[model samples]
Target: MTENSEANSPGWFDKPANINRLIVALVSACLVLLAVEAIFGKSFYDDHHPAHFPIEQMFGYQALIGFLAFVVVVFLGTILRTVIRRSEDYYDR
Candidate 1:
């Protein structure tokens, strides 16, 4: 991997500044969406769009549930990994 070839490579996010820019862009997008929801969510929900469950009417409920689901999936994946992991000497026998 010579310096010139590395510079010509196409890994845009390999640089620290690019990663930071990506993070900033994503966070800004989320904040903009959150602001839009905060300003419009109640009216949008109330305009003949009834929730299936009573709890769904609460603010930030969907975000909370999504985060909880993500946490549960990660936790289960960790446990599953430990249970199914192969020993280092698995093929040496």
Candidate 2:
């Protein structure tokens, strides 16, 4: 295709996003999750001490753990790639 044809081609806005539907879906998911937690979070919010941590803390810890795990995985990948890297024609005669 020519440059003019490519330039006229559709981008993301060619199909507009449903802002209202997205907002409604997001709100509904949050409400459902909150209801589920309220029903099953009794034990976590029962003990009048460290055991009585808020659900928010659990979410925070989960996020922190995921980020740390991702960082470790990425670091290991970089190290391995560097250690095993070779020229593009290393195997060619």
Candidate 3:
């Protein structure tokens, strides 16, 4: 290797990689979003929170509602999944 070649050459990794900048940008974006939510009082946690009852008092209601929601979701998923299962190897003679 000549002096001109070494002088003109990019040492190992001289070019900037995009991934580090992208990861930093994503982390900054999430922090900004959290900061905005903290300032504006808007949060998914607050939105999905259950009713205004104490921990001990609402256990039964929470359990009942949760069980109902679970049943409904499971029923819906079962119906949807059965639609795909109905076409099992029917075309093979």
Candidate 4:
């Protein structure tokens, strides 16, 4: 790719330092959110939930669940890819 084309494309996040900064920023934001939730307590909807699950009231519970779900999805997708993928030359015959 030419310099001009690369410049026009999304190259801002291509650097390792940029990616690290992004990760740090996201983690910091999550920590701040967790701190706020701990100080202010749950929302009205969460407070009035039918089930009294202890884990639900924990700080960062939603984030933990979301991260775990994402991990599971990625893991499953990797496994499924190996199972369903065919040889590149399978259709050449």
**If scored against the real structure, what TM-score would every candidate get?**
0.68, 0.38, 0.29, 0.63
lDDT of 3 at 62: 44
- The CA root-mean-square deviation of candidate 3, after full C-alpha superposition on the true structure, stands at 15.9
RMSD of each: 6.9, 10.9, 15.9, 6.4
Best by lDDT: 1
lDDT of each: 0.74, 0.61, 0.55, 0.73
| Number of the candidate with higher lDDT, 1 or 4 | 1
Residues 1-93 of candidate 2: C-alpha lDDT, one tens digit per residue = 121232344562244364454456666866786666666764644455554345445643544666689999999999999999999998994
Summing lDDT over every window of 10 consecutive residues in candidate 2, give the lowest-scoring window: 1-10
Ranking by TM-score: 1, 4, 2, 3
The total of clashing pairs for model 3 equals 0
Candidate 3 segments whose C-alpha is farther than 4 A from its true place: 1-16, 42-93
lDDT of 1 by residue, 27-87 (tens): 7876786777688876757647667787877777767787799999999999999899898
Q: Native-vs-model 1 lDDT?
A: 0.74
- Model 3 C-alpha lDDT versus the unseen true structure: 0.55
Give candidate 2 misplaced runs (Cα > 4 Å).
1-10, 13-61
Q: What is candidate 2's local distance difference test score?
A: 0.61
